[model samples]
Target: MGELVDFFVRSRNFILFVLLEVLCFYFIINTSNYWGATYFNTSNRYAAQVLAWSNAANQYANLRQVNADLALENQRLNARLTQLLQSKPAAPAEYQADSAFADRFKFVVAKVVNNTTQFANNYITIDKGTDDGIRPGMGVISPTGVVGKVKICNRRFSVITSILHSEYLVSSQLVKAREIGTAKWDGVDPHLIKLNDISLTKPVSKGDSVVTSDRNSTFPPGILVGRVRTIGVQPNRVFHDLTLDLATNFSSLSFVYVVENRLQAEQDQLEKQVETEK
Candidate 1:
């Protein structure tokens, strides 16, 4: 205490000078309207800038949650669109729709609990399962496009075979030329998939749209798969090899729709009967 008193005594002149300077400034601002206005204006500008910087930092920290919410909202919009489009009737009776399939597709919105793209046979796990009406062989899609097929399901969780996996396959069709083929990933680029068995006669070009074919019992027809970004005609190969830019960006995927085809069992039984006759 004695040392503190001695130090204060030693620096008393400097402290007194600082106090007097502060009092002089306060008196000038208080007595003069122009000075007070200028001081307040400067303080307000600095405060606003500080507040803006603080808000920006807060927004940056909340970006992940915002993105997840946006994904979920997009998924809901897609579901509503699907319902509206599917509820409409066809234009004619003689349409003979080979691509138009009949499947009671139910969308179960679930967040991705697990995902892997670095392996040969990549898979994704969701926070839904058999207890939630999820089952094996159920088709899964996102708001952007097709994701994969459900391969396994437990009580509250399910594993999906991602399109990036080697074993993943979907019955796909070229929307522009109506060329149906099998869509599979080459396990190279995450965004690219191979559309094989499409005939060379079909006039396919860059940016040609691709969609799911009704020929498959898994996914319903017209579900967007991707767009054809490149087409290559190989030597000695009968069909054109096409590259598709996947509609769904798997890296940012959070929510997915587990499409349950209600008529799947009935269709399987009918196919079994046909095979028995054969």
Candidate 2:
């Protein structure tokens, strides 16, 4: 206590001088509006800088929570989009349907739980299962284009044979000419698919739009598939090989709609009978 008193006694003159200078400055600013305004402006600028830094620090700390909220909101928006995309036309009052696939091509919203784009036989898994009415051969599509057909379904999850798979094939037709053929991926680029059996004489050109043809056993007619980017007509070949720029951006796929056809079993049985006889 005696040492502290001695130190303060030696420094008291300097402390008093500092206090007096602060008092004079405060009084000058308070008495003059111009000086007061300048002081306020300087203080406000510093305060803004401090607040900005604080906010940035807080955002950095809460980044994970913010990302989660964004993901949830995106999921909800995707669900709404799927609902809108799958809305069907109302049946007539006199029309009565008993079959599940015929009556309910219900769109079950599913998130892409797993995806692969680097393999020849790539497949994707969805969060939906048989319990959700997802069945084998049911079509899956994103907003941009057709995805693929369902390959396997478990009690709680399902796998889709993505259009990028080499085995994937869909009965598709050229929109401009109504020429029907099977579309398959060649396991090359993720953005391209192949249209087979389009006869060389069909007059297909680049940039031609291709869509699903109901003539096939799987997809309904007119689902957007892709657009033609190149056509190869080899000499003496029966069909023109078409390279397509697929409509769907497979890499960015997050949400999809599973098409549940109510009459798929019946149709399969009938088609099987026709095939056996042939």
Candidate 3:
């Protein structure tokens, strides 16, 4: 206690000088308009910076909700787009049905929980299921293009047969050449698929767009499937050997939309009855 008292006694002058300096500075800022203004401006800038950091944190926290909302909006737009694509462009405006009545397909936005592209029979798992109206044979699409077809569904989730699967096939058409064919995975390249049955006489070329064909019932017509990557001619083969760069990058899949055909059940029943009779 005695040593502490002695130390304070020795430093008391310096402490008093420091306190006086602070007091003088405070008084000068408060008494001078210019100094006060500068002080307030500096304080305000610090406060503004703090608020900005807080706001950025809040926005980062809300990102998941933002992604979900964007997904839903995309689903609605895609559903509307399908209607427009189904309409005949040559038909008169009078033939165009009202948007509400013209709706032939509904889309359910789903988050990808799992996906595989490294195997011959790759599959994708999504965070939606029968409860969300997803069912076997329903089509899935990403924002850029066709993704896969639903393979199985439970109450809360579903599995999809990825377009990369060995057995997966989609009826596709060349946009520029107007040739119809089947798009299938060769089980070799993750980025390339084969366009089979396109006749060699067709005008297919590199970079030509491939899209879902009208004959496919699983997915709506005209959805992008791929772009022609290469072409080859084989002796004794009537069809050209064609390769496509798949549109969907399955390795980076994050979200997708499941397509529901409003007329699917009706069409399936009619086709079944016709086969029964035949």
- What TM-score do all the candidates reach, one by one? 0.83, 0.67, 0.81
Q: What is the C-alpha lDDT profile of model 3 across 1-278, one tens digit per residue?
A: 99999998999999899999999989999899999999999999999999999999999999989988988899989987888777653358778755543467789999999988889999999999998888999999999999989999999999999999898889999998888999999999999999999998888889999999878678888899999999997579899899999998888788899998888888899999999999
lDDT of 2 by residue, 81-188 (tens): 434433432346666544343333455667888999899998999998988778888888776678998999999999999999887789898988789998898888
TM accuracy, model 3: 0.81
* Cα lDDT computed for each candidate against the true fold: 0.84, 0.80, 0.90
Runs in model 1 deviating more than 4 A are: 1-15, 89-103
Q: Point out the higher-scoring one by lDDT: 2 or 3.
A: 3
Candidate 2 least-lDDT 10 residues: 81-90
Which candidate model has the greater TM-score, 2 or 3? 3
**Better model by TM-score: candidate 1 vs candidate 3:** 1
Residue 157 lDDT, candidate 2, scale 0-100: 96
lDDT, candidate 1, 1-278, per-residue tens:
99999999999999999999999999999999999999999999999999999999999999879877886676566656655555552447554423233215567788898898777789999999998999898999987789999998889999999988897788898887887899998888888899999888889999988998868867757889999888799689889978999999988788888887777898899999999999
Rank candidates, TM-score, best first: 1, 3, 2
